[model samples]
Target: MSLCATVPDWQSPDLEVFSFFLKFCWILRMPMPTLQTGLPPGPKGSLIGGNLAQVGARRVDFFLEVARTYGPIASFRIGRWRLFLVSDPELIQQVLVTDARSYIKHFGARTFKPVLGNGLVTSEGDFWLAQRRLLQPAFLKAKVVSYAPIMAELTEAMLAKWPEGQSVDVAFEFSALTSAIALKTLFGLDDHGDRVQIDQSLRLTFELLTRRLDALFQLPLWLPTPANIRLNRAIANVNAVIDSFIAQKKAEPPGNDLLSTMIAAQHEDGGRMSARQLRDEAMTLYLAGHETTALTLTWSWYLLSQNPDAEAKLCEEWKRVLGGRAARAEDLGSLPYTSAVINEAMRLYPPVYVIGREAAADLELGGYRVKKGYTVLMSQWVNHRDPKYFPEPERFLPERWLGGLAGRLPKFAYYPFGGGQRLCIGVHFALMEAAIVLATVGQKFRFTVDPGAIIDIMPQITLPPKYGMPTTLMRR
Candidate 1:
């Protein structure tokens, strides 16, 4: 049986007792050696909850404040959990690249297992290595470039429905567009009925997952809480959609889509992925593949609307490169400004803003002795906005990326897609998709932020516009 099949039952009597004991220990402020010695300085927390309340209330701000207040490395406690936040680029490289083998996906990533299963994001060690190797070919540059037409076509179709000079939620629109593109590219599912059903299921699953992240204490999966029930149903719905696609693929001959490729993938031992494994990988790709790209586009539109000069530059570039036609794969190289706009937008609002990992062994990091079982956090949100690396870091300056300026920055200082071996597999796919979609849509329309609408960031599975970005689309 797979580890994912064993969802921890938190309501068990022994587990409840353990939880209570931990809470009791936290309340007494027990001076464990790990907590007392050689740890970086951070804000002292309450006896019981530590800094969790503050973090839960405003995750991004809390992280930024800690980094700002405590220098590059900071330490805090939540119950018995010791978390170390690393803000220095070199330390980040150590955790993600140089000494990466000493870490594993953090407990926070386990929150995704109910939905993502033991997929790439949550899996570890040999299994994760095998799965990554098996699925890598699907995301190769050649294969990803082939999907550009599908991305452009889908964006163009979505843009066709927009009424000129009318307010629309660009966030929602981009979500739908990207979801459609993800479906087509991954499964060749062009049927409108299937797309709608799958999109709703995936969205509901993510929504529930987001709520789970916000909850301070999690109930066991078997508990009959309303949220738990909804989450289970959403997971079921998503699994049904994925299983259906897998069944169809199994029945038919292989095609070039990711599903077909995955169906035909084999391990070095000449073994194929189990059905459950395939389901997990497919769901992982489906969720990660679209949500981040969609959020990037959403934030891009929001940022471009705020920065008219950037928008104008992007428009001019599209006109020069695309000539009033939909962007193709080949044109991505020529549309540096378009790429830069996406890059800057992601830097400002990274989709996966907070990345977490757990130390596999007691280790030294950032000149501090971080003990085993400690959670190590790295925030692109904080790093990307550091004025040390980026002058006027808060500003949306796409032009900064021109003339090899990005290459000059310190490694891990500007990782919108993260870094190292665990770096996003679909980086090329996402960049191509974003460029094509931006060019295709920008050639025909421009959006202005709707007045009196507050767009805030909701850092969940992805950083999404909290209130949904309301904007008016103007035909060009």
Candidate 2:
């Protein structure tokens, strides 16, 4: 079928009273309805869009100061939109878990529909409920346990390729490593060559997608400008790759592949995801699964590199547990310290730094009142480091976790996988994967950050290490 056929006649909507109800896929013409009141003050920037002008400069510092001053919820008007910045874990719990249905993702997610289609991350109401159910089984503990061997197998392969005493970008390496693992285990393969083309395309697509998603308030993606054109092309390349995979999967018998599980998933009403929905969901997993894990590993490696005592403890634990052998899924039960190390690193530099939601109705949170249509922002960056929960928050101390701090802390105080229902579906899988990969990599090698390397912060879809962590790997 032609691409034109999938696009609906949007003009028909303007004629109907139900124009607002139209799926955003083909209704890009209407002026977006503006949001008004949210909460109280922060750094008001340009008169046109408060704080939007400074979005490019030291956003980490800007957001930190906002959290410090606002104490949880703040309101700001950017462009034609009003936003409510939320930093309180209790309110975040209310919005994302308990009262989740009251809110919908911001319209910013509409741009992802072109790139991702309508998978779990983009679907709303029943569609989202149905999609999440169908894909849930494949990530169950037993099923995930089956993938641990794959993770260990690949970690060895990746480490072998690393050169001794040579400085390398551990961030990029972990990304590539996890990307390969996602392909193999998700698709029931031991090797992931077939997915390499799409895998590489993801970094490109995501970079563009992040920029476009961040600047959604400025203009639409259809503009004939250099950046927009490049982004569209990136989106198209990714769409084509995913579309091809879906098409190929259709011709084959139902297999153990994650895609097959999603394809065969049937809702209570007997509905299954459309190909586009599956495409989007698959892309979501591809993006969320790979990038976040990769970044976590990168930062974990960075922390281990910086703290020799901690790194020595990690190596000791690995050697004692595995003894020059490979790590397995069950072995993680005895490796709580390793898990704690990963936890501590993620606390300092989380993969999804800032999470957001849009208010479905007026709500009160953390001494502020938010109106409907206001943007609600939450940061793992601010919350995890809020000294109230984590003393000496800047210090990377893994022992705090193993020392019963996790129990002593309040609910949602350190939600690395996020909290409530929208919490990362793959939390278990990610933990297992990280434990196995960390143990495997730690057993074979150690990393040290190259001196004089400037560590900057880049707040894209995820807070990637801005300058990137280039470190030297010494073979153990």
Give each model's whole-structure lDDT.
0.86, 0.77
**Model 1 Cα lDDT, one tens digit per residue, 1-476:** 99987877878898898778778878899743343577899989988778878887888999999999999999998766799999999999999998889999887788878888989888988989888887788889988988887887788778778899899988888888887888788887763566567777766777788667656577898899998898898888879988987887778777778888888887788888888999999888988888899899999998888888888888888878778999999988898998889889999999999888899899999778878899999999999989998899889998888879788989889998889999999999898988888889888988989889998987777788888999998998
What TM-score should be assigned to candidate 2? 0.87
Of candidate 2, the 10-residue stretch with the lowest lDDT total is 187-196
Candidate 1 lDDT: 0.86
Best by lDDT: 1
Per-residue lDDT of 209 in model 2: 72
lDDT for model 2, on a 0 to 1 scale? 0.77
